[model samples]
Target chain A: MVTYPGLPGPIICDYLSREASRGRYGPGVEFQIGKIEMVANTGTYLDSPFHRYAGGKDLSALPLDSLANLDTVVIRIGGGSVRAIPRAAFQDVPVQGRAVLVHTGWDAHWRTERYLSGNPFLTADAAEYLVSQDVRLVGIDSVNIDDIDDPARPVHSTLLGADVPIVEHMCRLNLLPDRDVRFFAVPAKVAGFGTWPVRAFGVVST
Target chain B: MVTYPGLPGPIICDYLSREASRGRYGPGVEFQIGKIEMVANTGTYLDSPFHRYAGGKDLSALPLDSLANLDTVVIRIGGGSVRAIPRAAFQDVPVQGRAVLVHTGWDAHWRTERYLSGNPFLTADAAEYLVSQDVRLVGIDSVNIDDIDDPARPVHSTLLGADVPIVEHMCRLNLLPDRDVRFFAVPAKVAGFGTWPVRAFGVVST
Candidate 1:
């Protein structure tokens, strides 16, 4: 039950005051850790099928195997003139049963206004292609996996509906190699609570 | 930026609606993939110094290296008995520069009311002892790392003030060998947000 020592984003502060407060539960001093708030969509997080489909599994129902222990491939799409990511971007990559990381270099714009505009996103065809590959997960070093301006949001619907967990708001993808890195991005195990924030990370071979 | 697959939990129904509305710019729809509204203390979360100390490093101030790629060790506390987790519970365990995980059997009670009952926790002296060891992190498989019933909350104060991370409400610790498990439990990268929820996990030798 130990955690890494580090700083948290704004969402956590909101959570500590809202959900983690021990105001009720017991004596004013006895903090039983209150009911957590904050949408599952905050910060570096994972999106499950429940995030899209009406009948999809929630965070607590998701299996652990899907969240841990899988081979990973990072596609370094840094320094690109392209605005929209095309289907061909992942054509040559081996994505089956593996975690696919799209390094759009947009993480540098995190917490900034630019990170939201014209950021890199997977084309709908790419989403369908990834589903076909049986890829375990899809992550991006950008704001959202889908284009924010698009009303349809087909990319998110397609991937999440297929039971593929989405990891967004990720930085430091540049620190990982193209292959052999095992990716992990697991959410909390709250019953009936879908789409909360997560502390996603990867493990490179020693 | 790929992710692992997961089973939908009980709260998937509400999760879908909550996540989809956030959009991408403010908060994406697929971030926290689960369905329950958990406290920040639920499911292997980090406790920063701010959780106890009035003027300690919040989640955002801690270093990334401190939470990732840590050298870890495990101290076995059988059956989660309070007497089992004594000041001497960590004796002879190399503490300096190591993440220590105390294996208590309470994880088996996850999702049940018993998981939050009069569970085992470290005595204040035990907390001071670990601090003396200069351990990097401390974790346990129980409700709270310290007895919430206590007014002072010394265990939390001692470790968090020293910048050691504490992971609480963890499960499946029995799956890990006493040693050789690389533990990782990172929080959101939120500045001034100290107590966000996390998906704490470990990598076992394949």
Candidate 2:
């Protein structure tokens, strides 16, 4: 997964005292407590409908069937000169009720200045087509599914408005097969939150 | 799930301009961004080996097999006067290579002050027995798996020292069957972090 640029990854600090704990307990018993500070959108994350619409469903309200144990499809857009993924790219795939992942191979530039500029993105037409096909979820291996330079954010607006969740900043899409895999990208069930980081992975049946 | 007392729940704040986005794009194009700040131990959370040992495996280091799609066993301990769960509580069940969940029915007091105090926890002997049995993971429907008053945190020390992950503050354990269930408690893959909140749930075959 591509680490979010400028976002503090994770801060681990001591919470309880090991010496004090050991002294209070036995010699072999030494416990340490830690505290972490992180932003909701720090790394590879999912954006629920509430991320785009104020009254839309938040992370807590999402159904588990939509996020976990999903049939998945991987669309490789790497080695292509076109940056904007168009509707034709998805016309041939069976996207209904599956996690459609667009692998742009842009994760190679993760954590670098190159990752921030000229990243691949899905066009508004592609987002509309995915919505029409009734995809369960959409994911991309890029900084954002929409062009960051475009303040309109048409891709996010089209997909999230239809209650289709989006996973961004994913890596290792190349590791997954082109079709027939189980996908999961569940986030912490935090109420009132629209977006948060997740442990996104695909499970292939051996 | 029991919400940790005094811990801040998710807060969703607006990030981008809805009016500007709509004006820039089409009429229905309005985007809303959110910011969230939460304590890692706020709700039902998983503790990696690093939670107790600084040099041990962090969240990112944990294997997927250890966290997802494991056969689970639920042991109900409600309506009993006992607070300290002993090793004998697990004597009758098949716990080896499974996710053992102790359902204390303490989730009834979730989000209440009663949930914080007088919660059920595992004894040190119980943790040792689970380790000996080679259980994949342990979960409980209580404020914590260890007695919070005991600064020693014997349960955490014993379990985490054995590299067995623990999921605390789980709820709805009663919903799961006594056997033949799939358990998942995946946390965000944040490096250098020992503990973080998770979307803990079980998949029961229909």
On DockQ, the leading prediction is 2
Candidate 1 structure quality by residue, lDDT tens digits, B1-38? 00101111122234334455466324333333333433
Which residue runs does candidate 1 get wrong by more than 4 Å?
A1-37, A78-80, A111-113, B1-39, B94-96, B107-117
Candidate 1, residue B96: CA error in Å?
A: 4.2
lDDT of each: 0.69, 0.82
- A31-91 in candidate 1: lDDT tens per residue? 2222333445566777777666657887778887788766899987759445578778888
DockQ score for model 1:
0.27
The per-residue C-alpha lDDT of model 2 at residue A206 equals: 86
Clashing pairs in 2: none
Q: How many backbone clashes does candidate 1 have?
A: 45
Candidate 2: chain B TM-score against the reference chain B: 0.91
DockQ of each: 0.27, 0.49
